[model samples]
Target chain A: MAILSLAFKSLLNRKLTFFITLFSIAISVTLLLGVQTLKTETKTSFMKSISGTDLIIGSRGASSQLLLSSVFHIGSSTNTIKYETYQDIEKLPAVEWAVPISMGDSHKGYTVIATNLSFFDHFSYANKQNLTVQSGSIDDDMFAVAIGADVAQKLDYHVGDRIIVTHGGGEIEGHDHDNIPFFVSAILSPSFTAIDQTLIISLEAMEAMHTETHDHLGALPGETLLDSDHHEHHDEHDEDHEQHAAHDKHDEHHDEHDEDHEQHTAHDKHDEHHDEHDEDHAQHAAHDKHDEHDEDHEQHAAHDKHDEHHDEHDESHEQHAAHEHEDTQDQRIARLLKLKPENINAIFVGLTSRHAVLGMQSYVNNFQGEPLTAIIPAVALQELWQFFSLAESALNIVTTFVVLVGLLGMLSIILMSLNERRREMAVLRSVGARPSHIFGLIIGEAGFVCLTGILLGVILLYAVLLILQTPLANYYGFYLDINMLTSNDLFILLTIQCSALLIALIPGALIYKYSLSDGMNIKF
Target chain B: MINLTDLSFAWNKQPIIDIKELTIKKGEHLFIEGPSGSGKSTLLSLLAGVITPQSGDISILEQPLNLLTASQKDTFRANHIGFIFQQFNLLPYLNVLDNITLPCSFSGIRKHKALSQSKNLESEAIRLLNALGLDDPELLQRSVNELSVGQQQRVAAARAMLGSPEIIIADEPTSALDSDNRESFIKVLFDECQKADITLIFVSHDTSLKTHFKHSLKLQEINQATIKEAV
Candidate 1:
C-alpha cells in the first residue's frame, strides 16, 4: 500500500507527461472498443433486418443480390416475376401467406415499395415484430400512401401531404408521376430496419401510376372536367378504359400474363364499350331531368347509377352495398383507378411450419411458370455476413495495433522517466526499499494508468454512442444499444490490461538493476 | 557497535577500499575525513552492508553481514542502520511527515519501536521533528521541496533518528549547510544519537567539521588503498 501510494505521488508530480500518456491510451482504447461495437452491432442489426419470413422468392438470379435488393434496398433486381407466378405460389399448400412487392420507384431518394394490405398483415422483422402505424390508419384508397418513420421525418411529410414519385430509383427527366401524386395516409413507427426508409402503397396504385392513359387523363380538357355527371361516369369506367388503352397501345411490351388477360378483357370491353356508350347517353338524359338536385346530391345520384350498373354487370350487389356505406367521392374514384398488377419484383413468403422452408425453397427454384429463386433469409444473411468477416477482421487488427501503440507509448514514457529517477531509487534503497520494491512500483504505476485509461475509454464510447444514436438510425438504419456489453468486450479489456503489465516489465527490470548497482549512493 | 577486519573491495579491478581492522564501541560518535575520491563514500557503502567486501567480514550488532544473503542483508540494514546524505536528503514527492516516517514503513522493528514511543507513526514523526527543532505544525504536511536546505537536512535527521536505529551513517551531511547551520545541525544530530545511545559514523571530505567529534580519523592514516593511490 505504501509503495503504491508513493508511485501514485510520483506520477502526480509529473502531471503533464503522465496525463498525456493516459489520454493516448484512453483514445486508443476508445477506438478499439468502438470498432468492436460497430462490427457486432452491424452484424446483429443486419441479420435482424428481415426475419420470421421462411423464404424470399424473386426472378431467377443470384440469391445474395436478390436479398440485398429486396431486403436491404441496396440495388435493383435484374428481372421481375410475373403476377401469375406470385398467385400460383400464394396458392401453394405449404404457403401460409405471401406478400408481393414491386420496387423500382423512388420518392426523393427514399425507395417506394408497392405492396398490398397483406404486407402490413404478414411482414415481420427483428423477432417477429410487426410494423406499426404511428398516427393514421392504412386505407385501401389507391392514391393513399403510407410512409415509414424515417421517410416522414426526412421529407417532412404529413398525413395529407401529396408527393410525386419518380418512375425509377432516381429522378430522371420526364419520369416523374406528376399526374398521379400519392398522399401520405399513414406514418409507420420506426422498425430499425430498411422498412424505416421506404414509402409503401398498394400495388394497384403502382399499376395506375405507370399506365399511359393516366398521363393523358391528367391533360383532359377543362370543359370535360366541369361536366360533373359525365366526369363521374368517366371516372367509373376509368380502370377498364386505361387497361384497354394500355393493351391496345403497348401490347408487346407487357408480360405474357398481362397480354393474355388483356386479350380476354379487350374482347369483352370492345362490346361493352358500345353498349355502355348508349347507356351513358340515356343516363345523361336522366341526370338532366334531375338537374334540380344540388351538386352534392348529384354525386349521390351518380353513385346510385354506378351501383345499378355494377348489379347488372360484373360486380355483386353485396359488394355494391358494402361500397355504399363508405363511398366518398375520392374513394369512388380510387376504386375506379385501381388495376390488377401485371408483374412484381419479389415475394416474401411465410410458412405454417418452419420445417417446410427447405421444401418450399426447392419448389420455388423449380417453379414451372417462370424461372425463380427462393432463399431462406437467415441462411442468406449468414452468407452475407461471412463476406463482411474479412473487413471486420481487418478493422480488429488495426485497433489491436492502436492498442499496441498506446502501450508502447506508455513503455517509452516509463523508460524515459527511469533515467531521471535513479537518485529517487537510491534514496528509496537507503530507506530500506528492496530492488523488488522498485520493480513493483514501476509495474504498479503502469497498471494504474492502464486501468484508469480503459475506464475513461468506456465512458467516452458511451458518450459517443448516445450522441449518434438517432442520426445513425435515421441515416443508416443502425440501432445501437448503449447498454450492451458482451463478454467479448470484457475479454479484450482483460487482454489489454495483462499486456500492459507485461510491457511494464521492461522498465521494471531496468530500474531494478539500477537500484541494485547504485545501492545507497545518490547518483544524481 | 560496528566491526570490520581485513576488508578489501575493488571497483573494476581497481582497489577502492582496503582496511586492516576497524572497531567502534556502542554509542560512540566517530568521524572519518578524507579528500574527494579518497574512499570515504566507498567505506561508508561497505559499512552500511550496501556492498560486500571481496575479502573480509563485517559484523554489526554481532551479526555477520558477509554471511547473510543479499535480501537478508537488506532486512538487517533496514532494522539496524539509518542513512543521511549530503543534499536532496528528502524525497521531494512526499510531505515532511511522510518523509520522516518512510523508514518505519519498510522496517517492522522500526515501526514497532516508533509505535512504542508514540501512539502512531504520525505522532512519532512529530516527536522526532519537534526534537530536531522543527516545531512548525504546517511544515509537516508541506512538500519536502518547499523546505529550506537547513530544514530539509533537519527532516533527514529526524528520519534517520526515528525508531532509534543502532547506527546512523551520515555521508557529508553538513557539506551543503552554512557554517552556523552546520554547527546547530551537528548539535541536534549528536543530541539525538546520545539520547538513543546510537553509534554515529559520519564521513566527509570537509576536515573542519571533524573538531565536533571526539574520535576522528583521516582516510590516509588507515586506508592503505588511498595511500597506495597517493604514492
Candidate 2:
C-alpha cells in the first residue's frame, strides 16, 4: 500500500509524461478494437442481407449462380425459366411458397426490381428476420414503386413522390419512362444490402410497359429519347479532332513525323473510313448500273464484297435479335403461367419441422417445373463466409500490430525512466522493502497506466462510432447498429486487457533484471 | 559497544583501512580525525552496515556485523544506529515531524522505545528542537526547506537522537554551518548525546574540535591501512 502511494506520488511529479503515454496507448487500442469491430459487423450485415427468403425458385441454373444474380445483384442469368416452371414448382406437397423474380431494369442508379407484395410480407434476412416498417405501406398499384431505405434516404423521396425509371440499371442510363412515371408507395428501413439500393415494383408494372405502344423513339413523347445519326457523326468527328490536337501538344517528344501519323489515325478519309449507310448506297448504285465491261468486273467485286460483309453483319445482328426474342418469350410464358396476377421474386419459409431444409431440398429435386431449388440460408452463408473471412484475418493482423506497438511504446518509456528510478528503488530497498515488493511496484505502475488507457480507449471508440453511424449508413449502406457494449464486446475487452497485462510485464521484467545486476551499487 | 580486530578493507585491490585491534566502550564519545583519503567515511559505513569488510570482523553490541545479511543490516541500522549525514539527509518532502519519526516506523523496537520516551515522538521532537536552542515557533511545523542551515542541522540532530539509539554517527554535521552556528550546534549535539548516554563517533578533518571530545584518534595514525585492503 505504501509502495502504491509512493508510486502515485512519483507519477504525479511527472504528470505530463505519464498522461502522454496513457493517451497514446489509448488511441492505439481504440484503432485496434475499432478495426476489429467494423470487420465483424460487415460480415454480419452481409449474412443478414437475405433472411426472410426460404426458397428462391427461379429458372433452371446453378443454385449459387441464382443466389448471386437474384439476391446479391451479381452476375447474370444463363436462361430465364418459363412461368410454367414456377406454377408447377408451387404445387409440390412440401413446398409452402414460391416467388418469381423478373429482372432487367434500372432507375437512376438503383436496381428496378419487379416483385409482388409477398416479397414485402415474407422475405427475411439476417436469420429469417423480417423487414421493419419505418413509414408508409407496401406497394400495391402498377406504376407504384417501393424504394429501399438507402435509396429513399439518399434521393430524399417519400410516398406520393413520382420518379422516372430507366430500362437498365445505374444513374447514367440515357432513356427514362417520364411519360409513365412511378409513384412512391413506401420506403423500407435500412437493411444494408443490395435491397437497400433497389426500387421494388410489381411484375404487372413490367408487363404494362411491354404492352404499351412505342413511338419512333422507342418511348412515349415525353419519356423516351432518340440518338440522332447526323449529330452522332458530328460528335465523333469533333472527338477525333480533339484527340489529334492533344497528340500534337505532346508531339515534341516524337521525332518520326508523329503529327502525320496522328492525322492518319484520327482522320485518314480513306476507303476504310467509309460510312456504313454510304457503302450500302454505293453498292446499290453499282448493281443498278451494270457499268462498262472492264468496270463491270471491278464493280461486281466491290458489290460482292459489300454483300458478303453485309450478310455477316446481318447474321450477327439476327443472332442478337433472336436471343432477345427468346428472353421476351420466356418472360411472357412465365407471366401467363402465374397462378396469381401478382409477381414475387422470392419467398421466406418458416417450418414447424427443423427438417425444413431437407424437405425443401427433396421437394425441389422432385419438382416437375423448369428448375427449382431451396437454399438453407445458414449453409449458403457459411460458404459465402470463405470470401469475407479474408477481411476477418486482415482485421486480426491489424489489431495485433496495434497492440504490439502500444506495448512497445510503453516498454520504451518505462525502460528510459529506469536509470532515474534506480535511486528511488534503492531507497525503497533501504526502507525494508523486499525485492519482490520492489518488483510489484514497477508492475503495478504499468498495470495502473495500461488499465486506465484501456478504459479510456473503450469510451473514445464508443463515441466515435456513434458519431460516424449515420454517415456510414448513408455512404456505404451499412447501418453500423452500434450500441453500448454487448457480450461480444465484453469478450473482446477481456482479450484487450489480457494483452495489456502481458505487455505491461515487459518493463517489469527489465526493471527486475536491472536491480539484480546493479545490486548494492545502485545509487541511493 | 563496538569492537574491531585485524580488519582489512580495500577498494578494487588498494588497501584503505587496516586496524589490528580497537574497542569502544559503552557511552564513549570518540572523535575520529584523518586527512583526506584516510577512510573516515569508510569506517563509518562499516559501523553503519552500509558495507561489509573484506576480512576480519567488526561487532556491534556483541553481535558480529559481517554475519548479518543485507536486510538484517538495514533492520539493525534502523534499530541500533542513528546517522547524521554531512548535509541534506532529511527527505525534502517530509515535514519536520515525519522526518523525525521515520526511523521508528522502519524498526519496531525503536518505535516502541520512541513511543515510551519523553512523549509521543512529536513532543520528544519538540523537546529536542528546544534543547538545540531553536525556539522559533514557525520553524517547527514548516517544511525542512523553510528552516535555516543551522535550524535544519538541529532538526537532523533531534531526529538522529530519537528513540535514543545506542550509537550516533555524525560525519561532519557542522561543515555547512557558519562558525558561530557551528560551535553552538556542536555543543548542543554533544550535550544531547551525553544526556542520552549514547556512544558518539564524530568524524571531521578539523582538529580545533578535538578538545570537546573525551577520546580522539586521527584516522591516519589509528588506521594504517591503504585503499587496496579497504575494497
Candidate 3:
C-alpha cells in the first residue's frame, strides 16, 4: 500500500507528462464508447419505429422495397394494387383491419399520406405507441387535412390554415393542387417515426383532386354532373372568359412570367374570391386536378410538354378552376361523394389473431389474381439490422485499436522514466523494499492512469450528447436516451481496465529484473 | 555485529572481493577507506544483505544472512540496517518528511519502533531533523530537489537514524560536500550513532573523516584477492 502511494507521488512529481498520458487514454475511451452507444441506439430506434404492425403488403416486388416504401415512405412501390383487392382483403376471415395508403403528393416539402379514419385508429409506431393529434381531431373530411409535427413546425402551418398539396412526393415545385387547397384540421404530436414527417388526408380527397381535371366531370350517370352544371355545362359561359382573365391577372404574385398565361394558380385564387361573393357561380366551378398524399408519383407531362399541357389546362382551367370553386360547397355537400379509389401504393394489414398472420401472408403472396408480396415488419427490420451490424463492428474495431495505442503510450512513458528512476529504485532497495514492492508499484501506476483516462472519456461523451440533444432530436428524430449504462458499455470499460493491467505486467517484470541487477549499489 | 569468512565475489568472472576473514564488534563505528574502484561499495552491498557472497558466508546480528532467501534477507536488512547513499538519496517526488519515513512502509517492525518514540511518523521525522541541526520545520514539506546539498545530506541522515536501526551505513555521503560541510556532517552522524549505540560502517576516501570513527580499515588492505589482481 505504501508503495502504491509512492507510485502516486511519482506520478504527481511528473504532473505534465502524467496528464498527457491521461488525455490520450481518455480520448481512446470516448471514441470506443461513442461508437458503441450510437450502434445500440440506432438499432433501438429502428426496431421501435416499426413496432405493432404485423404485415406490410404491396404489389409484386422486393420485400425490402415494399417495407421501405410502405412504412418508411421511401422509394416507390413496384406496382399499384387495385382498390378491389383492398375490399377483398377486408372481407377475409383472418383480417382484422386493413388501412390503405395512397402516396405521391407533397405539401410544403412534406410527403402527404392519404388514408381514412382507420389509419388514425390502427397505425402505431415506436413500440406500439398510437399517433396522437396534439391539436385537432381525426376525420375523413374531403377538404380537411392533418399534418405531422415536423411538417407543421418546419412549414409554420397550424390548424385552420389553407395549404395546397403538391403534385409530386420528392419536391415542392411544379403543379400543385392550389385550385382546391385543403384546410389543416389537426397537427399530430411527434412520434419519432416516418409519420412525424408526413401530412395526412382522406382517400376520397385524393381521388377528387385527381379527378377534378378530367373532361368527364359532366358526362356521368344519373347526375355526377359537378356543381358547375347549374351554371351551364355548355359553351354559354364563354362570356365569363374575360372575367376569368381579369381574375388570373389579379392572382399573379411572382415577379417573372408572361401575364397571358397565369399558370392556373392566379386564376384559382381570383376565382375562389369571386366564388365567395358570387354564390351561384361557386356552385359549379371546375377545379383543376386536386391531389392526394399516399404516393406523390404524379407522372408529369415532361418538361417540354409542360407548356403545351399548361396551355391546354389553361383552356380547361377556366372550365375546371371556375367549376371547382363552387363545387366545394355544392357537390361536396350534395352527398355525391363516393369517388372510388382506383389504386393504392401499399396496405397495412392487422390480423384477427397473431396465429392468422402466417396463413394470411401465404394467401396474399400466392394469390393468383394479382402478383403481390407480404413481409413481417420485424423480420425485414432484423435483416436490415444485420447489415448494419457489420459497419458497427468495423467501427468498434477502429476504436479498440485507438485504445490499444493509448495503453501502449502508457507503457512507453513509464519505460522512458525508468532510466531516470534507477537511483530512486536503488535507494528504495537499500531501505528494505523487496522486489515485489517494486513490481507492485510499477503495475499500480499503470492501472491508475488507465482508470482516470476511462472516466474522462465517459464524461466527455455525456457532455457532447447533452450539447447536441435538442438539435439531433428535432432534425434527425434521434432521441438519445440517457439512462443506466448498458451491459455492453460496462463490458467495454472492464475490458479496457483488464487490458491495461495485462499491459502493465510487461513493465512490472522489467522493473523487477532491473532492481535485482542493480541491487543496493546503483552504477550511476 | 558483522562477520565475513572466505567471502569471494566477482563481476563477469573478474574477482572483485576475496576476503579470508573480517569481523566488526557491536556498536563499533568502522571507517572503511578505498580508492575509486577498490570494492568498497561491493563490500557494503554484501554487508547490507543486498548481494550474497559468491561463496562462503556472512552473518549480521546473529543471523546467517547467506542462509536466508532473497526476500527474507531483504526483510532482515529492512528491520536492522539503515542506508545513506553518496548522493540522490531522497526520492525527488516526495517532500523531505516523506523521504525520511519511507523505510517504515517496508519494515513494520521499524515503523512500530518509530511509533514507540513519537506520536506519529511526521513528528518523529521532525524530532530527528531537529537533532541533526536541520530543524527548519518549513523544509520538511519542500521537495528534495529544492534543498541545498548540506540540507539534503542531513535529511538522508535523519532517514537512516529514524527507526533506531542496529546498523547505519553511509557510502561517501560527504563526496558532494566541501571540507567544512563534510566535518559537520560526520560529527552529527557520529553523535546520532553514539546516542542509539548503532554500528556505523562508513565508506569514504577522505582520510580526514577516519579520525571521527573508533576504528578504520583500507578496503585494499583487507581485500587480499583485489591485491592479487592488481599485482
Q: Which candidate is the best by lDDT?
A: 1
Clash count, one per candidate: 0, 30, 27
Query: Against the unseen true structure, what C-alpha lDDT does each candidate score?
Result: 0.80, 0.66, 0.77
Model 3 C-alpha lDDT per residue in residues A243-350, reported as the tens digit of each score? 233222322311222342354453444434443353322222222121122121131222123335444565555433422334443234221333546688888889
Q: Relative to the unseen true structure, what is the C-alpha lDDT of residue A161 in candidate 3, on a scale of 0 to 100? A: 74
Listing every candidate in turn, what is its Cα RMSD in Å to the true structure after a full C-alpha superposition?
Answer: 9.1, 18.9, 10.3
> If ranked by lDDT, best first, what sequence of candidates would result?
1, 3, 2
Best by TM-score: 1
TM-score of each: 0.85, 0.71, 0.84
Q: What is every candidate's C-alpha DockQ against the true complex, given to 2 decimals?
A: 0.68, 0.11, 0.75
DockQ class, candidate 1: medium
Decreasing DockQ order of the candidates: 3, 1, 2
What lDDT score is found at residue B116 in candidate 3? 96
Q: Report candidate 3's fraction of native contacts.
A: 0.82
Instruction: Candidate 1: list runs displaced more than 4 Å.
Output: A214-337, A474-476, B226-231
List model 1 lDDT by residue over B146-214, tens digit each: 899999999998999889899999998998999999999999999999999999999897888889999
